[model samples]
Target chain A: MKPILPFLLFALLLGFSCSRQVQRIETDTTIDLSGRWNDTDARLTAAELVTEIMGRPWLERHVSKTGKEPVVIVGMVENKSHEHIEAEVFTKELEKAFIQSGRVRLVQGGEKREQIRRERADQQNNASQSTMKQWGLEMGADYMLQGSINSIMDAYNRKKVIYYQIDMILTDMETNEVVWIGDKKIKKFVKN
Target chain B: MKSYLFTLVFALVFCGFAMAQSSDQNPRAQQAYEAYAEKADNSHAASLGATVDKTYEAHDPILIKEQRREDRREFRRQLRLERARRPIIQNNPFGYYPYW
Candidate 1:
């Protein structure tokens, strides 16, 4: 009976464990902000929102007049969140969306842009007549796109609440006035 | 015996969680988590941006390690500055003598 005691106990434990399934219930008190926040996704979403608001009007009023895609530069995107988020990733998505819409034009911002323009000009100045005629193209951006990221968080040990806000604005370069503004927010609750 | 085993497992899990909570409460741990979260967020943005351009690449551990070393040094430097922000003591009853 003494020897059987241990075996009986072990069997009982196995049976008890088998009888119950572990249930993972997310509490209202907890916030989960863990996931893949791919740049492409952020950009694409931002672009869609922009297009929905400004694409049609901009196209009808200005884009149609040019008969060519109007070139625009994506400008500075600031991160004001606790997380060091790169605003450009989402900007890229917006860039692609505008391009795909075929309603407007897009150009690189900053030093990258200056380098491209300079290289083109240099090629034009230095190249043989045939090459210069073949490849010298000068394009100017008509507008600038800019945005900021901000976040709010409240939590105690084992539970948290987090909210993120991304705001973007498009301005006419010639006028220096904001033409379109877009905002998106993501909120999450996680419990540990 | 079964209940005893269960209690032991429960205790271990509870203790592990308690330790984690305590560590997270520590100022150093909070700073580390914030730093990591910031980096993670930026990396996400970078990865997302690169992916949009179809230019995303896998992280290089060697580069990451080198960067981390620099980050650690910067973190320590920042900690010193933060510590200095607090009021300094000129003299105290516990001290042997006052400052010059």
Candidate 2:
């Protein structure tokens, strides 16, 4: 009877876990289930970097030289970290921060740029002449923002220390000059 | 003849002032807005503006390391300046643990 009771309790717990209980939470909630990279890290890093990037002399220099708010486009952000991190999520956050600051102009790039071209092509065929979007009239991005995510892990016994470094750079599209460089470091200690 | 010369000088001064005012008014914002309104043709677009390239290229690590090292140095200097912004307290007869 005792053995049977233990088995029944185990089965009940397994069933309860199998039946997922999901509760809606606020978007701003910092829920770190694992010590791995998360949305909060991406968001906070982006927000902090935006302030630094905007405050840097490159922004003022660009304005002074060009007499315009430099048009920036989010480029490739390669994830070279230990875990599988979605680079798009971080890139989107960076783009969002730039746009929200209202300091620099933002433009679409990558797959989205292709999608826009496809739409323009379609419009040429279907839409009226007046309403159809023109070709080759797109805003040329002045600066390309690219970076890499790298990590160094130190593990001893059952404890692990993970350090992630996210480096972001802004380069002149025409000159290939790295105008601005910013980095964010996140270190977490996990013990088992 | 004197009145005519005076009128010419006045015209030149007014013209210079107008030019300075026009230059002060940055046209960048208006130019971008007008680009939309004008709907510029793509006929010569191929000859204009640099294209965004290098879909994926690694950054120079050495240069970045140097930049980071410089940044750390700058940050330390900033911290020192910030600390100095507040006057340091010295040991007094009425206070303890104030020596620095």
Candidate 3:
């Protein structure tokens, strides 16, 4: 019993010493703990792709031909990566870049657009005649941007390489013409 | 004791020979070595200079106007590609839902 008591004391000390630790880090910091898809990859890919897309000649041509900024709506960004990745995370980043550039106009689409329409319908009855929002006044999007994320992974024993590719394309809604195609490819070599 | 002394002497002789072989004696040889080192430094500088920094100047009115016109035409050509791909969204409320 005396020996067991000393062993228990040692175990408790070891347990306390081995306790997990956590620390807060900056949101934009590049941290690759498990060598998988992470915030850094999403941010870098979105930023680079958006920069390229905005800098392309298509934007200038659109503005010159139409004499106005092109109205764009984000359609979909499908995640087909080897690992589970949230496409929305990067899609929202792309949207943010477009809005921040002040060169493109964005319109609400999908469920959010429907919600706005529903509220406008409710306003038709509840709101005052002057203040009530009119129906059929929604701005139509002239272009749609969509993309897909794909990946290739190769592993040999303790060494592995992961390659991720994100492809985005902007299309003219009226002509169904693809205006621009931009891609971001990230490759990582991990060894254990 | 004899073997230890012999080993020490042998080691000292070998190290002395290595050091003598490494030292440059002739003034011409030393000059040649310095010249080679300078050449290598110059080569490295030239390699660095090969990486030209691209700068755009909008001061030239004619060049800028021509460049802008070319850019617009190129953009129209790129956007006029055949309609092979379609927009991912149809009537779906949510644009794209990830399958976990």
Candidate whose DockQ is highest: 1
* Regions more than 4 Å wrong, model 3: A1-15, B1-100
By lDDT, the candidates rank as: 3, 2, 1
Question: For this target, which candidate reaches the highest lDDT against the unseen true structure?
Answer: 3
DockQ-better candidate, 2 vs 3: 2
Query: Which residue pairs does candidate 1 place in steric collision?
Result: A30-A189, A30-A190, A31-A189, A31-A190, A32-A189, A32-A190, A39-B48, A40-B48, A84-B38
DockQ result, candidate 2 = 0.02
What tens digits encode model 1's per-residue C-alpha lDDT throughout A1-192? Answer: 699999999999999988967777643233324522444336555655666645446656565666666677776676666665666556666777777777677766565655666777797879887766434344667877767767776666555566777777778776687777878877766565
- Evaluated at residue B46, the lDDT of candidate 2 is 31
Clashes of 2: 0
Clashes of 3: 0
* C-alpha RMSD for every candidate: 30.2, 22.8, 35.8
Q: What does candidate 3's lDDT look like per residue over A1-192, in tens digits?
A: 678998999999999999999999899999898788899998998888878888999899999998989999877666666567776777787778779889999988766776687899999999999999998888888888888778777776566787888898899987799999999899999776
Docking class of 1: incorrect
Clashing pairs in 2: none
Tens-digit lDDT string for candidate 2 (A1-192): 678998999999999989978899987789877667788887778777877787899988998998999999876666676577665666666677778888899987665666688889999999998999988788999998888778887766556677888888999997799999998888888776
Off by over 4 Å in 1: A1-44, A47-56, A64-69, A121-126, A133-137, B1-100
lDDT of 3: 0.77
